[model samples]
Target: MRQPRKSTVEIRTSFRGREAIVSGAAAALFRREKEGGFFGISVKLHARVRLKVIVVNSVEYRPDVDCYIRVPDPSNATAVAQGFAPRRCHVDDFS
Candidate 1:
């Protein structure tokens, strides 16, 4: 069992518009604590990143296999966004 960390994350799918609204990535971890407290690690996903992954299904699908879909990447992209200026804006005007 790994210790869970507190962090906020938002995962979105690229295939269509599906999304997993999680309070924190740590909530996804499943573990037991020796002192009776649960422990896990959380993942902080970026707001602009997307990712495509296979997710396992239960009851209707096989446990060994799973389905996949495009989702938001778990990395920060604010810097990238800041670097790009609006299409209407003139690059030379800033200077």
Candidate 2:
């Protein structure tokens, strides 16, 4: 899949009735929306991309998507190992 252009850019956003569905990383705080049509959120972010990450032991091979996920801690260690954000290792790293 073709990855969307990844670039952080500042944007002023106005959410319509309910069409504020956006994807990608945001590095800003979104203020609360007003009653009528108002500026819902303004932030600095990257271009939206289709991201689907597989937290396997494999690092060299990632699915055709973007995911820099970090699972919340204090859950279960087993869940962490087999869950999100697995270590990215080389061939020699494994037996």
The C-alpha lDDT values of all candidates are: 0.30, 0.35
lDDT of 1 by residue, 1-95 (tens): 22234656554533333664354653343212212232222223222222223454223221221223222222325433334222221122111
| Ten-residue stretch with the least lDDT total in model 1 | 86-95
Model 2 alpha-carbon miss at residue 62, Å: 25
C-alpha positional error of residue 11 in candidate 2 after TM-score superposition, expressed in Å: 21
Runs with alpha carbons beyond 4 Å of true place in candidate 1: 1-32, 49-95
**How do the residues 18-73 of candidate 2 rate in per-residue lDDT, one tens digit apiece?**
55435433312222222121222222223333334554333343223232333423
Model 2 compared with the native: what TM-score?
0.16
Top of the candidates by lDDT: 2
